[model samples]
Target chain A: MLIPHPLLGPRDAQEFTYLGDAALLARPDGMAEGALGAFIDYVYLRDNPAGVHRELWFHEQGDRSWLVVTRNTVTHEIIDAQLARDVALARKGAVA
Target chain B: MRFSGFRVIKEALTGHKGWQPLWRNPDPKPAYDYVIVGGGGHGLATAYYLANTFRKARIAVLEKGWLGSGNIGRNTTIIRSNYGLPGNQPFYEFSMKLWEGLEQEFNFNAMVSQRGILNLIHTDAQRDAYRRRGNAMLFSGADAELLDRDRVRDMCPWLNFDNARFPIKGGLMQRRAGTARHDGVAWGYARGADRAGVDLIQNCEVTGFRIEEGRIRGVETSRGYIAAAKVGVAVAGSTSRVMEKAGLRLPIESHVLQAFVSEGLKPLIPGVITFGAGHFYVSQSDKGGLVFGGDIDGYNSYAQRGNMPVIEDVIEGGMALMPMIGRARLLRVWGGIMDMSMDGSPIIDRTPVEGLYLNAGWCYGGFKATPASGYSFAHLLATDTPHETARHFRLDRFARGHVIDEKGMGAQPNLH
Candidate 1:
């Protein structure tokens, strides 16, 4: 399902670097450090393990509200994504 | 006995102690020229103005319950005339003017404390919207002052001006907007209308309308069928049920709006403060209790008791504004049904049925519009044509796409 981004931003694609079938972690910037690492940890906890599939993400450094990145589960290639609070809240509930 | 002042005091005391009925109707007229349904503030004000202004003495205001028992007694009682839309600005301003003169005209104490109303802006979009609304109010000859953070701090010191989550940037303040005793307003108009020879009928519920050849012949009430040349339906929340009896349906949806009051403190809230980011507003009553309310309950419910979610949201907003109020215990909470239209404004015009007029769909802001509603409704009942101030609130405006949507919510509840 296509969900509209609550925040305004440009979409980006990243190659999904899957760690495992239960838990797959893909970095949109391919660089994990400090606050970004903290955000990734939050995302992981928010979107807990499920069957790997297509996922979109967005980097919210500009506004610190949302992020945009897309991923494909079959090939582990991200298509498009953006940072949105509703998405964050939804995914967090799912993962929890 | 050289006691001149004492004699004057004695005479004044005797006049104040004049005989009046405690609850029963002192005088009941079999027929009146104009019969207004719903003896709330709007209905009583209509009767008062009709008897005083139009010289229509044979007027009767029918109330199913005691006067002020409905939403008039249940509202938060915040009065403001800071309307942004053209259709609303003039009418509310007129009502504000009437509020100023109500005490003298009715010989009743309304306790209208003009402590000012401030709408806080938490985001850039909200600030921009308030700026536009301030300009509109100023252009329309209404008082709307824009205040920055420093100014807000100077005005209200208790507010969390530097909170990062919802920083207080600025606000649109109307110094004329304040609150009055809600029950006092109802009783003031009732006593004034009663003194002016208007039959104040209590416990007379209008069950249906007697329509003949598309014109309202009279109303069928629990007491009896009262004949009337004209009838005005000022029943706010129960508008749909009253209209349904006339074989008509309105574009109004009914929902219960809840309000709560906290235990009395020394003095915390100086004036009415509204959170523009959320649907929360608060003012302090004369009894020292903090009176506050949020938006209406989302779903359609005739039940007056509201759920816990709304109460929690309202208190959360309050705590966000004033953390000091966290210690203040909630004393009481109550709910009143609101007949919300598709738009947030009201409908004050003649219905398609002849001799049947409506002054309902006030949403949550009906208390502030009491005087102007009475004035315009009286004018409509006196003459068939609606006053220029109330012409935009026609019943057919919704179907014609001529909606006066002030909040721009269309038909949504959260937008207001």
Candidate 2:
């Protein structure tokens, strides 16, 4: 599988380390109220769908950037890839 | 008819004309006392134990496809009770006891061979861990032995013991653990369930659940609606998808695990040998082909295939342990989906939805847990109570902060 990195072009999947669902990026504050429940869902639960999935992959062997890759889990076809920092900043901006 | 040497002789004399189909292709009934989804090994075992052991009646096993088409027929077929944790050791030990008497109880030849297994130790710290695990196995009423390097060498001398980086120090051996015929176990249980008047319905896919208020009344299927008082789901790979039909979300993720076999050779591997330093485990099949597998692909996928990286990683581990294996040509490779749970353990308890029970999250260990999983799930579905050995497999364990982290990898489904 070739992961199309935003900066590195199409890199082999072996170079990236998989951290599972992109939902891990929206980590809840451990010090807040109802934080335990939030963290439980954030850590344990996942929408493990059989179709398209947005997941986090670390380019550990190459650029060392976290990329949010939108790919179909069934066919292993990558649709889009971008730096996770940009996606996180955009999500926060949209929320604000 | 029951299988025996006398029967074999009789059939041989009769030109093999007296043999019949292993199970009947029964049509779905309008209603049953209990309905089991997923006619794989666990499902058929559940139905088998429900009628024969629990003495329940009117049970129907609905299958999306034919029986033994899932992970039941896709695993490496190793059965052992070498667990260390309290939450898992007792349960697996009970399953090992069940495996001891399975063939005679079901009257089918599953080739239940207790040929022993060896987990090679490559470091001093790993040796201590195996010692603790061996003691735990003994405490759980299972046999275990700590063999030194010389003993391990006597058992299998072809190992790369003088390697510079990771040498074989010793091994943990379980004398009474080995492999069984994966497909035979499924067929035996299906035959026993069918003969005991349980309907074995095939090509019947469960589409939705007929829940009245908060309780399940029956399941809507591709065939038709079949009313059932209680429902038990034993679909490991499709656990999340099937439970979602009942308006439920599980703390489970599906990942694909691959297995491989090489060209047939002479008797090479004695029993099962696992490389403690890596994720590789191997054994030679009865047909002389070397069967082996390693870690699951570290991602969420429903595709029943894995990528090249995991394959390379597994073969590298094998080569590191035994350099002689590099000469054998790879013959076949396949993948089976795993319902990896949060804590690396399984869940065999009742769901919050009334009249619904769950038996999933077996991950890579589903094949070994088939008999006891069936027995425990049947006990729960029959008496509405958790089995003694399986009480810790609750769905709320993760929420209650009582997760059974067997591998000490906290809350990571992929790592487990």
RMSD of 2: 1.0
Cα lDDT of model 1 by residue, B1-416, tens digit: 11245655876889846445523484445677899999999999999888888778678999998898898899998888899999999889889988998887886678898999999988788889889998888877789998988899898888988777898988889999999988889888888787778888988999999999999889999998898889999998888778888876666656678999988877767899998565678988888899999976554445676766678878888888888889989999998888777778899988878988999889888999999999999988887888888999988776666889997875443245
**Candidate 2 deviant stretches above 4 angstroms:** A29-33
**What interface RMSD do all candidates show, one decimal each?**
22.1, 1.0
Report residue B127 deviation for candidate 1 (angstroms): 1.9
In candidate 2, the residue pairs with backbone N, CA or C atoms under 3 Å apart (3 or more residues apart, or in different chains) clash, namely none
**Model 2 C-alpha lDDT per residue in residues B52-126, reported as the tens digit of each score:** 999999999999999989999999999999999999999999999999999999999998899899999989999
Instruction: In angstroms, give how far residue A16 of model 1 lies from its true place.
Output: 34
Q: Please report the candidate that would top lDDT against the real structure.
A: 2
Query: Whole-model Cα lDDT per candidate?
Result: 0.76, 0.93
Every candidate's DockQ is: 0.02, 0.78
